[model samples]
Target chain A: MRENAKDPERHARRMAAKQKIMQSRIDHARKEQGVLLVLTGPGKGKSSSGFGMLARALGHGMKVGVVQFIKGKFSTGEEAFFRDLPGVDYHVMGEGYTWDTQDRQRDVAAAEAAWEVASRMLADDRYQLVLLDELNIALRHDYLDLDRVLDDLQARPAMQHVVATGRRAPQQLIELADTVTEMKVVKHAFKDQGVKAQKGIEL
Target chain B: MRENAKDPERHARRMAAKQKIMQSRIDHARKEQGVLLVLTGPGKGKSSSGFGMLARALGHGMKVGVVQFIKGKFSTGEEAFFRDLPGVDYHVMGEGYTWDTQDRQRDVAAAEAAWEVASRMLADDRYQLVLLDELNIALRHDYLDLDRVLDDLQARPAMQHVVATGRRAPQQLIELADTVTEMKVVKHAFKDQGVKAQKGIEL
Candidate 1:
């Protein structure tokens, strides 16, 4: 271990080689455009991850629009903080989760209304980042037409980054996305420890 | 569809039932203590999700401590934004990723040093949230002793929430964690689209 630690020359050579490879890759990846990201799966942090991007966009002084598709039943901490921030257009349009509503037709109407708002934001060039929170849930429940959603997404402004987050993303949306993350459930507190969602951490 | 939309009374009844159930569950979840969360697997957003929690902690006026275990080589937007914030103790104690470093002894040494900083923060009661970014990568490579890391985590203050982010979390750590998320890579831009990590999004 001591001998390995002392070999600074070899480490320097190795790093140089890596730097060359990375630089070439970086150079090759020169295309710059807004990306569509999908966060899905049965694990936690899908929405939380979307919010992180929202925060990042805010940090960059970019205009952000958020349309919550199925999470307006309970107030979240992110809403309380980012809603009041300047250059943010935040809207919570859902009545609640689908299971809580239990009315398919009503849920469909609510989702359509939410998508109307989302479509407008996607069309508007002023917004650099548009977060369609829980849109996958709406799509999964067949509350929103997949074809119409795809068409709207395709027609969005060239520089507008869109992030759709929820569990069980549709195959077509995944195919259309530049980045798709599936948050697999390794272990959940609700399932394993019987710990319900809390304010600071889970809300 | 019109008839379903007009049935407000039925919707109200269902919502009321859900409200009652949710409220009871919320009441039942009265136990409040610090949560240890592990965000792992092979996808993006592990660190991003941890940052979201950091933001939540900040919103609650809680002190935050961040130790970047394997991301010190480059300047991330999160570090640029949060490092200067009041009540945030930010430390980037890595020589980049292990693959980049390519020196096991040096990587082990760096991991130990980073863990030292993490251990101090975990022991301090002043920090309500401590984020150990990319610590799982270090653990996966066996750069730091798992038993020691678990011991330090176990000794943290009762109300100090800890979040460790990276891929391939150890099974023992998962067993001990209150919440664990595995971010599966459905589609990565680097792999599929050849999109490099962007400034505001990936960094």
Candidate 2:
């Protein structure tokens, strides 16, 4: 043990205090309802984190609906795996990245189509979890109407969770979200070390 | 079509310019090597994000090693499902949360034991990806020597990817990592809405 380590009795007392505080907090947090989670920022893993929740939802046998708003240029490992799973309604609606598609009109059309799918899923009580992958990008580019999206999200079932992921999330969405996580980029191998996206890791 | 949409020819020209820039940047990024990823901050889904990477690694037929540093209190749905899959070596190595254990010495011992397992996997070439879950917490409480942990991580195989997940990651670890994502808390349902941790979502 380190020489400066706390005595066992002292540690016990400290932990007891912590336990009491945590227990009280846990007890106080008794409310149960669905949550709207938004993952946004200039870092990696926004969609990946959303997929993690998808996996968790699937593990619990919950019905999930996934609508890819802006990612379809390259095939992702997640789409390959989760699409085959039971209780998952997966739809890849976008043609590709905005720049790759090379057409603002086409991008708007795709975003609208994706939003239609997402709105239907949000309205359906049978789907416990709905993931709108890269919806933020579409919103960022003004490819979809922000007001309509917010109104639809507000009208979702009380017990249905919704997760929207991508960079540059709208401030309105952030304000309405029950939980919002911004993935800050501390370091990125792609930018700093000239590292290409790996098969399993990045794709 | 939206009445004010950009002309198709103009949109195509703009996209062509973007594609050229993107292609040049993509062409410049030619390095291939394993990445050290750190997921840290005061928000949810740090571990969930790590699990997503684990799933991605598995989908590519990569061998994965998981050493849970401080999350053995409850049986997680992820553990129950992923443990059954082939090519995954999963070890749950903590009595429970630090407050739950209430024993500093015991917690330190458990963390050290878990580190030993992590070190071995880091050295082994068979495991392509290794996830050290809640390791930042152990390091945060000074239960483990950060220097030794850094040295071991530095000594790992060149092609092995390691992911560390937890809040308050040491600055030294962040400096060493290839990809670092800080999950900033915009809002938490537990703190703001009195929502308790759900079974599949929080377990």
Candidate 3:
């Protein structure tokens, strides 16, 4: 026996309803709201991943602000690549990593300076992503305060993505995070073969 | 013009030598071997990027492993996406987040258990890339020994790539890194809009 086929108009109506629901779900699934991403682990390529995201966002014409907290010195490949890119706003630790700062006050001052740029970016709703590089360690090291950071982060005007990468994110900070990621060390190349870090590959 | 045509091989030799020199400098730039990548910071896509790398590596027919430290008991879209993929070894936090554990001893014990699997992967050269998700915070919280982790990473069998994502990477770890990235938060949607974290986007 042949089953009766539905009318074309009814079939189209049903399909349209299904498509609408699917589209709605897709839209909801997208992280259109600003997100906090914490990248913690003792591994390589955390910042590389952040740079890669920055590049992709910039490619799409999204404005980006990068505030490196602990690391300032050494010419990074990311800095060299995106310093002049139209949508990129980059700030490095011109003095280098915190340990080399030689003065805690100087380290704190540098962090504050970087945060000034970062804070402005956060306030400006134009940026799609703001990278607070190594900020967690900065806080852990007392370069910045948790209350002030949380307050400022809360005060940002609109939907803006933020990335904080470091190893010792405070409990309060993690609690506040929308998304937390921990990178584990399973195995690495340098350990196995004594290979030194490569510039483009590592930096 | 005729003389230039005769110099093609000479030009190739010079180019090769330049590449070699660049490689050597990159290999020798750092006093330490292996690159420590701490993927810490506040952002939404750290794990996404790491898993993206895993997908690319697997696409290239390389083996990969994912050991999630504190993210079990929660539904993750990434887990759904990669769990069934070939050439991937999956490990989720058997226990939930540390706060939920409420016992320092137990949290340390869980970290140890996860480390067992992660450390094994770090030692094995089978996987081209191993993602140690959330291991940074564990170390920061003193759930694991820095030296022990470094020792395992140093002794890894194959020249493997490792990605560690978290927040607040320690100074010692930063000093040990070939590349360090900080994902700074300049703006965020949650603080401004009070939007609840939706599934797939934040979870």
Q: Listing every candidate in turn, what is its Cα RMSD in Å to the true structure after a full C-alpha superposition?
A: 3.9, 2.6, 18.1
Better of 1 and 3 by DockQ: 1
Count of clashing residue pairs in every prediction? 0, 0, 58
TM-score on alpha carbons, each prediction: 0.85, 0.93, 0.49
Worst 10 residues of 1 chain A by lDDT: A1-10
Error of 1 at A182 (Å): 0.9
Chain A TM-score, cand. 3: 0.80
Model 2, TM vs. native:
0.93
Instruction: Give the higher-TM-score candidate: 1 or 2.
Output: 2
Residue B101 C-alpha lDDT in model 2: 87
How accurate locally is residue B171 in candidate 2, as Cα lDDT from 0 to 100? 92
Error of 1 at A112 (Å): 2.9
Q: What share of the true interface contacts does candidate 2 keep?
A: 0.57
lDDT of 2 by residue, A56-98 (tens): 7777778999998867433366677678778999999758987
Candidate 1 C-alpha lDDT tens digits along A15-55: 67877887777777766667899999988888878887887
Model 2 C-alpha lDDT per residue in residues B8-41, reported as the tens digit of each score: 7766777788889878876887887788999999
Model 3: residues >4 Å from true position, as ranges?
Answer: A1-32, A72-75, B1-203
